[model samples]
Target: MAIKVLVVDDSALIRNLLGEIINSEADLQLVGAAPDAFVAKQMVKQFQPDVITLDIEMPKVDGLRFLEVLMSARPTPVLMISTLTEAGADATIRSLELGAIDFIPKPKLGVAQGIEEYRSVILEKIRTAARSRVKTQRTKVKATSHLSYSSTEKIIAIGASTGGTEAIKSVMEAMPPNAPATVITQHMPPGYTSTFAKRLNNCSKMKVVEARGGERLLPGNAYLAPGDRHMRIVRSGADYRLELHDSERVSGHRPSVDFMFQSLVKSAGSNVVAALLTGMGKDGAQGLLALKQSGAFTLCQNEESCVVYGMPRAAVQLGAADKVLPLEAIPEAMIQQLEKVKAGSRL
Candidate 1:
């Protein structure tokens, strides 16, 4: 049976376009289209859709408000449709925190042109959302006592997708103020990465910023790969700096985890700690394996704690990860592994 999807938007044009795109896919069935949240609530009972494509702005009730209600009540997979502006980016990130599976940016151009341009992305998000597990209750992250460690030469590389926003936040919050240099690649569109990085910065003791080319890596700070760019680590004498460039998408993502991990395997080798977090696809598996083979410490998030286990599952199957840990346990695992590396180096 085809995956059943419902389209919810205040605009008739968007509703029609979404319906058309969904109908065009052989594996997707458009169950219903609602112009507002009021209509959407009724259709949810009537059609019983497998996934919902929600617009952030809607008549009667807003998308975020409705999403909160729906997740609390029914816990269905929801993919948000948002504009590509700064305000849109912030709202979309909030939606993810509210249990949305993912979001796609609405084109800035006219509806018809934008829909046609982003048809593939929209369809793929729907498929991914349909297969995702929706949680009614989000994990509450408690602030733990921070560990105090002097700056070390270790670098931590992390990659995440689907449910990574919260997962990354949990790990970052648990880290000490003097945590080692960190690099991250989360599958997000262009406008949202800066906001995501800022949000992470606010919650964690470490400084977090979106990677701009040529910035030197510093202990106690994390660099997030900017959307639409591939970020690689390069050595500058005895120090490390980032190189961001436009490149073909790897594993279906531009700032791919594989790209960053492979670069680390070449530059940092045994000095790196890499973790593959929750995501929907196998983007980081091969690069993680390469990192492990190069003597870097590698870890993967366990399935039970994952929002979507695709990436970590691939790494585990490929024998890439040295440890498989729950979300709450990964920070300590990384710290322990890094300490082991430090001890071995002294010996």
Candidate 2:
């Protein structure tokens, strides 16, 4: 049986283009293409698509409003087709919070030409979305950060891909104001990571900013890797400062989780605590293993809590994670490890 897909966009060009791509894949079937949310709602009820690709800026009923309703009522996997602008990025983040599995960044230029360059990427995201877990988000009372450890020397490194924005928010919001300096790398494009950082900052007690090379890592703050740059933790005398690299892609991502974790292996391995969260590929596996080998306390989100278990599964297969935990359990677990490491250092 082929995976059923529904394309919902106000533009006929996008709908037709996506239809063509879905039809090209033998394992994928295009169930319907709707020009607006009303038509999309009808198609969704009529075809019962396994996956939906929604344009964020749709006419009449917008994608976010429709997504909220669908999640409350139908709860199907959704992937937003978003413009790569700053505004688009902000809306995309909001969509993720509302239960979207992932997003497809629309080409800023010629539709056919720009999309042609990302043909493989577009298809892969669709397939990934099809397999993702879809559930309406539960309202959890925010956990106050109880991180009591005050060592600025300890570094927390986190990486995720698909379903990451929400996961990252979940972890960050629970962190206490006094938590150790943290670095996060979520596989995102350029304009989006900045928006993501801003969003996190609004909810998190710790100050969160996009990493821009040479900034010293400090306790009570978090740094997000720039979307286009590979962020590395480097020893600057006695301190750890962020370094951004415009190097070639590693493990198929520019600001790859693998590169970030592997970089820490040489710089602060023994003092680092890392977590590999829900993602669609094995990008963070080898690097997490390397960090574990270098004496870091490493964690991977358990399959039960993951939207896509590919990345964490790889780490588990490699014997990388010290603890395979649920999303709600990871933040406190990370802080506890920090406390343990701190106590051991004192001894």
Candidate 3:
């Protein structure tokens, strides 16, 4: 059966173009094109689409409000249509927190050509969304275990995509203020990572900032891979520094989890505790396996806790994860992993 999709945008042009795109694919079916929330509500009831493409700046009720209500009521997988501007990025992240499956940015240049260029990505995101779990917004759950990792010898690495922003927030905020240095690569477009880092910093006990290469990896601080750029860890004297690379995309993403994971395997794998979280592809699977083989403690978010169980699922399949855990349990697991590594015992 074709995956049913609904286009919900105020713009007639967008609705038509997106409709055409869906119809062009034999595996996708256009269930409805709604111009506003009122019409969208009726269409949603009438068609019960498997996936929905939502615009943030919809008339009257805005996408976020609609999403909150929808998630609370119907809880369906939704892909937000967002722009690349600061405001757009903020709204896009907010939508993800409200239980949206993922987002696709609007073209920056020629609308038709730009969107056409992203045709494959858009289709892939839609297909992934269709298979995604629409997670409910639960009260923030903080880690209950005591965290005491204060050594510069320990490193924590994380890789995520799709539903990662919220997942990252959950774990980061639960970390202790003096936690080990952390590195992250969350699949995102250029110009969005800065905003994301700032958001994470605000809620997290540790400082979080966008990686700009050559920054010392300090305890209680987290470095986020700059969007579209690869991040690597390098040892300088007695300390580690985060470095950025302009190399070609690895595992289909520039800031690939695999790229970051493999770099740690070469330098500090034994001292690292890496976790692969919710995403829509196998970008981090091989790299995670390498980390595990290099003696790093690796973790994969369990399928039930994942919004899109692609990356972590791949890691689990490859036997890359030392433990498969739920999203909420990962922080405690990381701390435990660090203790085991510190004691130099895999047991």
Candidate 4:
């Protein structure tokens, strides 16, 4: 049987294009295409699609509002169609928080040209969404008491894709004010990381900011690798600073988890705590294994808590993760590992 897909976009061109692309795939079947949320609501009830391709900008009922309703009533897997603008990026991030599996940016040129260019990406995202786990209930994170560890000279490296924004927020919010200097690489496009960092900063006790190269790492602060760049950890004397550079895509992503993890292995070595979270591919598996081999305590989110379980599963299979934890348990696990390292038992 083919995977059922519904395309919801205000633009007839986009809807038709998506419909064609989806139907072109041997494993996919286009169930319906809606011009607005009103039509989409009816189509959703009638077609009961396995996956939905939603446009963020819709006429009457916006995509975000429609998504909230859909997740509440139906809870189907959704992939957002977004423009490559700042406002579009912000809204797209919000959609992810509301349970969208992923997003594809619209081209700056003509719709037909863009659709043709993104043919493979659109098809792949649909397939990925079909297999993804949709979270209907949001996890509420409570503030925690601060840990008293000396965060100086200790570093934490994290990497994720797909469901990473929410996963990163959960872990960051659970961290106390005295947490170690942390660096993160989440697979996102260029215009979105700043917005994502701001969102994380609002929820987290740590000051979360998009990394600017050459800034020294400080405790109680988190540096997010800016999108479209590879962020590396470099040491100068006793201080570790961020180094951001434009690079060819590695493992299909710039600002890749593999790049950051490999950098930590070279610079921070055993003084690091690294976690490879929920993502759709094996981007960070080998790098996490290298960190583990260098004596760093590594963790991967277990299948029960993951949205896709691809990256973490890969890391676990490669003998990289010292602990395979749930999303709610990972922050505490990191703190425990930090305590062990501080106690001179490891690192």
Candidate 5:
């Protein structure tokens, strides 16, 4: 059976164009098209599409708000379509937090020209999203216990991409407010990291913010890699600090997870707990292996809970992860392990 797709956009032209593309592929079938969220909601029930292509801005209700409602009612994989401008990037990031599976930037030219330019990308995103399992957790749950850190210096380092927005949120929400300091690298565009940070802060127990140069890696705080720059761990006296650099993109991502993890291995060494989460690529796997070799406790999100099972799968296959966990269990497990190390230090 062909993968069913629903195209939702405010523009009639875009709705039709996307439908055409989806219907063209033998593997994908265009189940329906809607001009707005109101219509889209009804179509979802009627079409029962395997995937949805959603626009950010629309009449009556915006894409993000509609997505929230849609996921709550009936969880389905969604692929966001946004303009490539700075504003569009910002909205796209917000949509991710709201549960979009992935996104494709619309072109800057005329409607037809724009669609033509991004045709392949849009199709590719839809194809990838269709294969992913849509997981919408209805309840918040934590692991059996929290880790007790005897030393105040323990830190958590994490990396993710693709379906990471929701995945990261799942892990962070399950953690204690007083958990160890955390450093995260999630692939994102410039001007979007702040919004992502804010969203995470709103939903999580710990203080979450984008990393600023020279900021102290404080206990119970989480710092995200700033977009457009590489973030690395640096030691200052007895404390660990974040060093932001305008370096070349590694693995096609600025704020590369591999670069950050490799640096953490050098700066924090065995004192760090490294985690490789769900993503579409192998960027973090090699770095995670190095972290394991350097004596850092490493964990990878298991395939069952992962959006793509790419990065974490690579890490596990490379013998990097000391433990492989479900998405919802990662935070509590990390906290517990950190506490274990801390308790040992005090002994």
Candidate 6:
């Protein structure tokens, strides 16, 4: 069966255009259209849509408020339709925090096929969204054993995939504004990661930004690995820096979590916090183990709060995770671990 989609926008022109794009794809079907969030809520039950395309601006409640309520109540996958302007970017990022799966910039109705640029991405997002299964409230369970750590500027490396959109969000949201300079690898397409980084920057207190070559890893700044390249941390005497490499895809992933974690072990030795989040594969398992062998603080997401427990499960099986906690506690645990390092305590 085709993936059922509902397009919600105040403008009838935008609704019709989106309907056209979705209907053109054989795998996607436009089940319904709504002029605002209120109408969209009713249509959701009426149409039983697998995915919803939501506009951020509307007459009544607006998109962000609606998205929050929807995720808290119905928990359906939603794709944001936003303007390309600065305001749109801000709102788009906010929507993602509220559990929106992905987004497309607003189209210019004047130009021919202006809306078509988003057709491919929209369909792709819908397909991916339909497959996702993020829950309303994240769970955070404590680990059975205590993981050792100390107060030093250890290099932290993380990785995620599949339901990582919300998985990463929970982790970052729980972190302090002045957290460690962290690096992350998430499986996402080009242009998307940039937007994802921007979204994270807005929602999280930490400085979350897209990775660039040779940028210094500063305190409290979290760099996201670019889509096409692998991000590795290079030690420069006392300070740390980022290296964007086009190395062979490890475990079929360019920004492979294992690749970054393993490289950190070789460069920073045991001075690292290696984490594996919710994903569909075992990409980070072996690398996290490497970090553990080298004495790095290792963590993984437990099944309760994960959208899919595959990646973290693999890491646990490999004995990579020193502690496996629920989603809400990971950030707090990270902060504690980093404080231990800063205090110069023994691991």
| Global Cα RMSD, each model | 2.2, 1.9, 2.6, 2.1, 3.6, 5.3
Tens digits of per-residue lDDT for model 2 on 1-347? Answer: 99999999998888888888889999999999998899999999999999999999988889999999999889999999999888899999999999999998998789988777778988898889888897478324357557655766788899999988888899998888878889999999999999999999999999999998999888889999998899988888888888899999999998999999998999998899999999999999999999999999999999988888999999999999999999888888888888776732211
Which sections of candidate 3 miss by over 4 Å? 138-140, 144-146, 343-347
Compared with the true structure, the alpha-carbon lDDT of candidate 5 equals 0.82
Off by over 4 Å in 1: 140-148, 343-347
State TM-scores per candidate.
0.95, 0.97, 0.96, 0.96, 0.83, 0.70
Candidate 3 lDDT by residue in tens digits, 90-109: 99988988889888998877
- Give me the runs in candidate 5 sitting further than 4 Å from their true place: 16-33, 38-47, 72-74, 83-98, 105-121, 143-152, 343-347
Per-residue lDDT over 1-347 for candidate 4, one digit per residue giving the tens place of the 0 to 100 score: 89999999988888888888988889999999999999999999999999999999988889999999999999999999998888999999999999998999988788899899989988878887888889876555555556656555889889999888999999999998878899999999889999999999998889999999999888889999998999999888878989998988888889899999999999988989999999988999999999999989999999988888899999999999999988888888888778766732111
Q: What RMSD does model 5 have?
A: 3.6
| lDDT tens per residue, model 5, 60-174 | 9999899999888888899988876767777887777667888876666788887877777677777778777676652344733545453446778889987887777777787
Mark the regions of model 4 whose C-alpha exceeds 4 Å error after superposition. Answer: 141-144, 343-347
Clashing pairs in 1: none
Report the Cα lDDT for residue 311, model 4.
93
Model 6 Cα shift for residue 107 (angstroms)? 6.6
Q: How far is candidate 1 from the true structure (C-alpha RMSD, Å)?
A: 2.2
- Give the per-residue lDDT of model 6 (tens digit) for 1-347: 99999999998888998899889888888999999888888998798888899989999889999999888778898878887665776677667656776677776466327777767666766786787665665443332122233222666677898667677876776666555577889986555678889877886767999998898776567899987799888887776788999989998788888889878987886778777888766898999888889889999988877666778989898888899987777777776777666634322
- Compose the digit string of candidate 1's lDDT tens values, residues 188-236: 9898999999999998999999998898887889999999999999877
Candidate 5 Cα deviation (angstroms), residue 53: 0.7
Model 3 TM-score (2 dp): 0.96
Clashing pairs in 6: 150-340, 150-341, 151-340, 151-341, 151-342, 151-343, 152-341, 152-342
| Location of the lowest summed lDDT over 10 successive residues in candidate 4 | 338-347
